[model samples]
Target: MSTDSTSLKLKKEIEEAADFLPLLGTDYIELYVGNAKQSALYYQAAWGFQPLAFSGLETGNKQSASYVLVQDKIRLVLTSPLKEGGPINRHIDKHGDGVKVVALWVDDARKSYQETVKRGARSYMEPKSIEDENGEVVLSGIHTYGETVHVFVERKNYHGAFMPGFKPWNPAYQPEGTGLKYIDHMVGNVGWNEMGKWCEFYAHVMGFAQLVSFDDKDISTDYTALMSKVMSNGNGRIKFPINEPAEGKKKSQIEEYIEFYNGAGVQHVALATDNIIETVKKLQQRGVEFLKVPSTYYDTVLDRVGQIDEDLEPLKELGILIDRDDEGYLLQLFTKPVLDRPTMFFEIIQRKGAKSFGKGNFKALFEAIEREQKLRGTL
Candidate 1:
């Protein structure tokens, strides 16, 4: 009867017909940084990420060092170049420490790479096997946008601490997790007018399907504008929303990211949590700064989004936003730039049942972002 209900019905139909990619979920996300040890501490102290494993000169890798952190199903590998003039150094010099690899768990890494490469994807890594005492892992990759890569990881046979070269790292101090479950989605900011091409790459090459599309009118405020298309696999475990800057009165956030990140790169990581209030409290206590909306935005938010179960005060107190679709509602919040370069940040999200992203909170969310941009003198 309602628009939301009809949309939900169509969504189910689309899922039924979507192609299965024989993929599990995100295995891990690897980031290139200037200092792996320092960044690992930052994640531990700020985001309650437990030190899971590590690899470096300690593990006989002389070129680079990597620290693996885990919070529930989400894993982050922070890496840094140990030498100059290497690819890692070049990546950091150009992009200043952003997401480099989005590793996906799959049943067959070789088959996955073959399917995508045959569909016109550029090869980044040919399928290779690495074995250790635990077992062996098959890894393959293909270039996505910019220098970003999608790594298909077949670890069903491996049970080591992590991959092949890493050793288990259990430190004396570890931050308690903030109820973060896993990655909900990873958002990318492409160069001008590149969103459509990348979205097609996901659809045709990776066997993903377009879930939703947002134009500038829907995602912009008065000063900045961007267009985005959400793409997901058949089972809906992996989601990637590609964004491209649209013409606006001023430079859009996507454009700013592309400029500072030196071409296209990951914009933000959306991590799913179960309890918003508790997770926000824990993150805030650990010194994580979040974007804030005007308190006035919450005065009528409930009236607009319809009946919601969460008390408005906790949300307003923590700067969390809420939206309701046909299936249910979701609570979400955005973090300030994790780095000084204003390139990459994170999102903590909790979806009760709503399949849609927070379309209702776009204006308020962008306004909050614009305020941050203004402070940084980017807008």
Candidate 2:
């Protein structure tokens, strides 16, 4: 099939998928960490996240402490258990510091929950309204792959710093942002052959469409391989690329992640930046480390992706990868795992009219990842 025809077909499918539920965008991503206070400090200093809200002992919540941080459209809630013997503690013990909830902003939380539940989604939380002096916010949730969840948030009637249980947090230490605009996409690493199952769940339960698919042939390095499918909603506001390990000479990154994370879970969050060069420079200055691909990879990148707006020297110097589709091209870089376990990481991406994931760069990207796995002695 021609590139134009393929793009058109994918666009039509995406448009058709939007009729199920009305999702505005990603509201916030909540991570259950071991220490909310120290993690908040690390995010504020290293990732340029500004303190937004807090919910804990002072707020009369004796169970757990939650810290909310915001950078542009991205809001991160880092929560830690105040008391022992709870789900939060168990999650921390099992998965370490990883994403527990992916909240979506919607028009009506109740209707969203009803439609999805009626479509076979397991109910995680029924629609519940919480109010404060600001107003009222309704929230509902459903379980997704692994223990990860999708929470529907209806906040049009609220005007608070965050939600009802949280108060505004203004600390003396404030930092500048890294030009990350919003979440581009999030990738999930499922178990051996669970990618197709979760893909069906998203398609039938949540009304998402498969935008693209990659076999082991497309994503394989010499030592490792994996299969993935990209699922997107109608408005294209949310995208999830689900991956599972494929048979290979050595352990693939997907297998390594599932083994360390103890099960299927989120692998990485891709953050979008308008100016990736500037944003990556600032992140590097703040002690962020990205995977290093061989410099030879850049020698033929422009030849494949064609001409781009930014110069190649800076991108190559900073170890960013480039790929092109029918629409345009994209620049992306992956960081090493931010936690002690080689589980979750971050992807910094800048889309230059490209709607597709970085298919053309998968081999090089996976080769770089394999190098990291080798260093950790996991491959």
Best candidate per lDDT, number?
A: 2
Candidate 2's error at 164, in angstroms?
0.2
Q: For every model in order, what is the number of clashing pairs?
A: 0, 0
Residue range 36-147, candidate 2, lDDT tens digits: 9999999999899999999999999999999999999999999999998999999999999999999998878899999999999999999999998888889999999999
Please, what are the lDDT tens digits per residue for candidate 1 over residues 1-379?
Answer: 0011122122232453244345677999999999999999999998889998999999999999999999989999999999889899999999998999999988788999998899899999999999888888889999999999999988777777788899999999887888999999999999888898999888888878888999988998989988999998876878899999999999888877888998999999999998989999999998999999999999999888887778888899999999988889899999998998989999999998998889999999988888888998898
lDDT of 1: 0.88
- lDDT of each model, Cα atoms only? 0.88, 0.91
Best by TM-score: 2
Candidate 1 collision pairs:
none
TM-score, one value per model: 0.95, 0.96
Model 2: how far residue 160 lies from native, Å: 0.6
In candidate 2 the C-alpha lDDT for residue 31 amounts to: 99
Alpha-carbon runs more than 4 Å astray in model 1: 1-20
Q: Model 2: residues >4 Å from true position, as ranges?
A: 1-13
- Number of backbone clashes in candidate 1: 0
